[model samples]
Target: MEMVYANRMTMQTIKSSTQDQNPPTSPGDQHSDSGVVKDTMAKRSTLSETVNQLQTNYSSLKAERDELLTNYSSLKAERDELLTNYSSLKAERDELLRQLGSKVEICEDLFALQIFISMFHNFWIGLTDSNEEGTWKWVNGTTLTT
Candidate 1:
């Protein structure tokens, strides 16, 4: 008797589980279920598209950043080169100025020499008397003894 009772209880449980699995469905319920599935799929596809777009934008930005870095490096190299050239030119200019100063000093000395020569020439001319060879007289009216 216990075995029979247990079998009957088992059979009743199986029947209830089957009924729960296949709950009575209406035609309208089937349409609503399909609609929910379609909406969920649409949302998933939209989210996937957004993610793809973001990934593409990220790649493009990364490439641009790399390009900018390369350009910056090139410009830095050029700037260093320019600085080196500027230093060299500055040294050359300083040397040239030193040479020019020396030349100016030489020119001033030459001008002084020319002025002295002119003064000496004028003094010799004034000290000479054209009267006789032995009558050489100074401009102050002093006669030469020799």
Candidate 2:
């Protein structure tokens, strides 16, 4: 039986005892005083039971609260660690992008130099003449075309 139901039943019994009171109590009627004493003892026992249940409930709740605190702290630490790792990875990605951009600039410079070399070589070929027909050659005796 639930504690609340048991308590209510006990309360009803006490009320009945009170309602059946004797109108005039003679000193010889030791029964009336004994009845009152028994009712009081029953109330005290019920109250004691209620108090013990409340204490037990409190202890259970307190332990649950401690477990929640432990879980919260662990989760907080994990979140911090994840944030740190994310920030570091972001920084590393930015660094890699910066390096790639620098390399692209260097490659562009080298490409421009190669284009200039080809243009100068063409100019020299234009300025020079073919010693014989159908033979295109450079000043360095390298054959320019077939």
Candidate 3:
């Protein structure tokens, strides 16, 4: 009889241990789990939207960067063309200056060098003699008196 009672006590202790390991969930625990699931879902949705917005912003910035690079390339080409033109103009101006050393000026014989130099605009005198030969005029609409 004592052995049978000991066996019954052991079985009850084993059942209690099993119940402790796998506890039954109450209504409050179920509600809490549902709330956690809802919270996790909300967080996931927010994160997805944030990622999409970031991707859109990245695309916009990339487009802007591409446009700026294109503009830079165009400006660089224009600058190169301008530099080439400047070099050509400088060479022509120097050649004209050398030729002027041999050519007699209309007013240089009568006026002082300073007086003739004062009439020059930026030290450049453009004669409009190409259109009509023997009829010369300054670019600023001053007719040659000689």
- Better TM-score candidate (2, 3): 3
Q: Model 2 over residues 1-146: C-alpha lDDT tens digits?
A: 65544588898887877855555465545565776887899999999999999999999999999999999999999999999999999788778979865221122255775776765543222324468676766556667663
- Note each model's CA RMSD in angstroms: 23.8, 23.0, 11.6
Worst 10 residues of 3 by lDDT: 101-110
Off by over 4 Å in 1: 1-32, 102-146
Clashing pairs in 2: none
Error of 3 at 82 (Å): 0.4
Error of 1 at 146 (Å): 69
Q: Give the C-alpha lDDT of model 2.
A: 0.72
lDDT of 1 by residue, 24-133 (tens): 48664555477788789999999999999999999999999999999999999999999999999978877897986522112235577677676554323335767777
lDDT of 3 by residue, 9-89 (tens): 899887877746435477545454777887899999999999999999999999999999999999999999999999999
User: How accurate locally, in lDDT, is each candidate?
Assistant: 0.73, 0.72, 0.77
Q: Which whole-number lDDT from 0 to 100 does residue 44 have in model 2?
A: 100
**Which regions of candidate 3 fall more than 4 Å away from where they truly are?**
1-31, 102-146
User: What TM-score fits each model?
Assistant: 0.49, 0.48, 0.51
Which of the numbered candidates is closest to the native, going by highest TM-score? 3
